[model samples]
Target: MTIHSISARRANRSAEARVADQGWRELASELNNHGCAVMEKLLSPEECAGIAALYPHEEHFRSHVHMARHGFGKGEYRYFRYPLPDLIGALRTALYPRLAEVANDWNERLGLAQRYPADHAAFLKQCHDNGQTRPTPLLLQYGPGDFNCLHQDLYGDLAFPLQVAILLSEPGRDFTGGEFVLTEQRPRMQSRAEVVPLTQGDAVVFAVHNRPVQGTKGHYRVNLRHGVSRLRSGMRHTVGIIFHDAK
Candidate 1:
């Protein structure tokens, strides 16, 4: 099988099983080692479908011009904001609670949860003391022939080091060309990037910044630079969740 196939297979496994199967620990170790890690199928198929159902296709999704030069280019790209109520409304009462639970569990495992209750308390307290607040989630939709640039999602003073995306389109079905690429290895200027083509019901998690070295006041974070390969045909829909301090 191809590397992508292997990665996809690894990602498609059960989250709990993956965690127990050494992959989760390996992923966490990689994040600790390289400042980033990419995991697939962070969400269940049912949950992914529920999220897609709530995605508003008719509502206007603002084109992200802020990083157009980076590779976003100019075509059809839209953004959607999500509030807690909206999430509950979209996913329905029955599913919202479970989804929230899953989100919290994921956050805790990824070390993004508030620290006071955990080992990262000092860091969490520092962020709160520094005026960082929670950030809202958003949905990104790319239409046929659309694309986006590679840039970071830096908002406010909150130190949001993780970002996630839920795939709503089926590969080779609802879309054919949009692929998520990340700079892997090489010099900063000539870094080799990896493309992660996802299918419906797939979820990806990645770190937004690098951990700080010793003596640093804060972690050295980079904007999680990412973008879609041109969508040759069909539409691509994704739900992005960015966790941050409440403003």
Candidate 2:
């Protein structure tokens, strides 16, 4: 076989690997019903540990944020710089098109005109053109008594509808009392909260700001915010993949 043929076959396999996963259809259905879906063991324990280990390396990140200083809660997080780590960059590229399909569907249901492009690079170009050039992927760390405030991940005008967070530390072994929490605010109704269960290497994809919810009359938009409950003991680590760039 020619070298070009082998390369083409490899590329096709990569593309197929991204979208042909068994769980994607189920994930979409769950997102349509609930504003969030969990992808269990998206990474292996070794991969999770490798990512969490990057948290202490200053060269990998662009900026560090102290949550208390910004009134964002108690923990700390660091935004990754450009040229993301290979696994993260690959995951970001692989996951976007799948989520974009669901995002476009939600936009149509909510009567919004915006549509996401099928690929991550094109969507990123759109963000960069609008002056949002900073990468949004981040590593977050939490210790005893630490927590994150409920907030949307919107960084600018061109926010992607969905974002993902992967738990890098084992819950029962590495932490306790720190739970992933999400809240939904419906019009003329009380806010509802959801506690997402995650283990090491597990990921949860959820609304970044708003999502369409079905009602008696038609689909309505519901505001969403996610955070972490206070940690009572030990430590925890997580990685966030936000498709849109920050200004």
Best by lDDT: 2
> Candidate 2: deviation at residue 185, Å?
0.8
**133-206: candidate 2 lDDT, tens digit per residue:** 99999999999999999999999999999999999999889999899999999999999999999999889999
Instruction: Please give the distance, in angstroms, between residue 132's alpha carbon in candidate 1 and its true position after superposition.
Output: 5.0
After the best TM-score superposition of candidate 2, give how far the Cα of residue 87 lies from its true spot, in angstroms.
0.3
Query: Model 2: clashing residue pairs?
Result: none
Scored by CA lDDT, what does every candidate get? 0.52, 0.91
CA lDDT for candidate 2: 0.91
Candidate 1 matches the true fold with a TM-score of 0.58
**Candidate 2 versus the native: TM-score?**
0.93
How many collisions per candidate? 13, 0
